[model samples]
Target: MSKRIFVGYATKTGSTKETAEAIAKTLSGRGFGVDVKPFAQAGDLGAYDGFVLGAPVNGMAWHPDASAFVRANASTLAAKPTAYFLLSLAYGVGRASMKRAIPARLAPSSALAKPVATACFGGVIATEPPIVLRLLFGIKKGSPRDSRNWDDIHAFAEGLAAKLAPR
Candidate 1:
């Protein structure tokens, strides 16, 4: 039987969900049985052979639900081949500090259970966010942008097939 992979995502503005779908599609094409769902609805973890957790960076940290998922499923995740992927706007604007900061942010999940793989991808942000979101992100005004690199995202999924190869 093909390896069954579960992809659970936590999305704020929905970009992470899309990324999860892309990863699931690529992994499915690679012959693994993949299921993608939001963290709130992600079903039984014990049913899958491997897992991929996707989340967007928010306020310099992995989304809270992502962190909570790891915490909730800590033991189950430890026994499986688990991977992680992050979508963040932390790239391209040339913030060198993010290199160190992002990993620090990821600790909440990574510390709970070691992962077989990890990937960080560029993210998307709306130009005119709601006033609260704008204030939270320190956004004044600008054109919306999507810096997601599909090639890299697909390549990450391809690499995951190897990392999650059936035992």
Candidate 2:
């Protein structure tokens, strides 16, 4: 059977989706079949050989749907090789904020799954949106910052692929 790699992401305005797509593309280029899906739509993990979970930080924690997915699938996840990525504003901040904000934890199941290689990427902060939508959602835009380190992300993906490849 073809090796299957599943990428599950939680995105607010698409940054997380982009990051997941990048990883999926890289893995697919290496010959693995990749299935990319939002966390809510992702179903059983039993069919995949490996997994990549990506999420954005909001109010200092993972998005609820991502967390819920982890909680719901922890057992199945624990049986496979998995990795995680976090997108947040802490990327450009000084050492203190970076230390506190980055390296957010994955759900327990993911942690228990094969050792999880993780990446912390800087995310986009939308400056303006429709006022009505922002008001209804209580959205507050953060300052624009390029916090993503493409080199780091690429390295992490490469390393994870290497680790998950057939022995």
Candidate 3:
């Protein structure tokens, strides 16, 4: 039987969901049985052989659902091959800046279960921010943009598949 993997994600603007699906698709092509689902919809973790969890950084932290899922499933995660991916506006800030920013954002999850691999991907900004957020962040409607690197995402997924492959 093929190894079973689950890719769970939480997203506000949809970039993270796309990321999870891309990883699932890649892993499926590599011969794993992959399932992609929202964090809220994820059921028991024990049935999966490995996991790929992803979420967007809303402020300095991950979306609450993603963090909660990690905390709730830490035991199972620690016993298996687990990877994490984060979508953040910081990734758009340049490589050095992103390198400096990643640890802080990952701290919470790392404390729960040490991921076998981790990746940070650039985020897509809402074309029109809510009035309050726009005023707070000084972003004009349609000003910010999507900075996701598809190649980087694919490479990360490929690497994850390799790591999970049986020897």
Candidate 4:
């Protein structure tokens, strides 16, 4: 039987959900049974052989639900082959910037259990963000756009498939 994998995410403006879907699609293409869902709807971790959790950076941290999920399931995650991905504008700037910033952003999740694989990808700016965010990020209206790299996202998923393949 094919191994079953779950891809769960917490998205503020849907970017993380899209990333999780892409990861699930790639894993499915690799012959694994995969299911992608928002973190709240992911049900139980006990049903899957492996897992992937994704979240976008908000104030240099993961969405609360994603961190909560990791904390709640730390033991199960540590026992399985698990991966993590983050969506952040820092990635568009450069890897060095991302590397320097990731530890604090990932502290909540990593504190629970270390992921077998990790990836960082650029984020999207919604066409219309709340006024507070616009001022905070210096994003002008109409400048909202995506910077995610599909090729990199797919490559990360492929690597994850290889990692989760039966030994």
Candidate closest to the true structure, highest lDDT: 1
Considering only N, C-alpha and C atoms within 3 Å, which residue pairs clash in candidate 1? Answer: none
lDDT of 4 by residue, 1-167 (tens): 99999899998888888889988998999999998998889887788999899998887787788888899999998788888889886554334645467547876687688888888887887555566765555545665378798999999999998787543
In candidate 4, stretches whose alpha carbon ends up further than 4 angstroms from where it belongs are 94-99, 128-144
Q: What TM-score against the true fold does each predicted structure earn?
A: 0.86, 0.80, 0.85, 0.84
lDDT of 1 at 65: 92
Per-residue alpha-carbon lDDT of candidate 3 for residues 21-121, written as tens digits (9 for 90 to 100): 99999999999999899988888777788989999888768888888998988988878888888987656533454446655787888789888899888
RMSD of 3: 3.2
Q: Candidate 3, which ten residues in sequence have the lowest lDDT sum? A: 90-99
Candidate 2 per-residue C-alpha lDDT over 9-57 given as tens digits, one digit per residue, 9 for 90 to 100: 9998898898888888888888889999998787777778988888887
Better of 2 and 3 by TM-score: 3
Residue 163, candidate 3: Cα error in Å is 1.6
lDDT of each: 0.82, 0.71, 0.81, 0.81
Where model 1 places Cα greater than 4 Å from the true spot, the runs are 92-94, 128-144
lDDT of 3 at 146: 81
Regions of model 3 farther than 4 Å from truth: 94-99, 128-144
Q: Which sequence of candidate numbers ranks them by lDDT, best first?
A: 1, 3, 4, 2
The total of clashing pairs for model 2 equals 0
Which pairs clash in model 2?
Answer: none
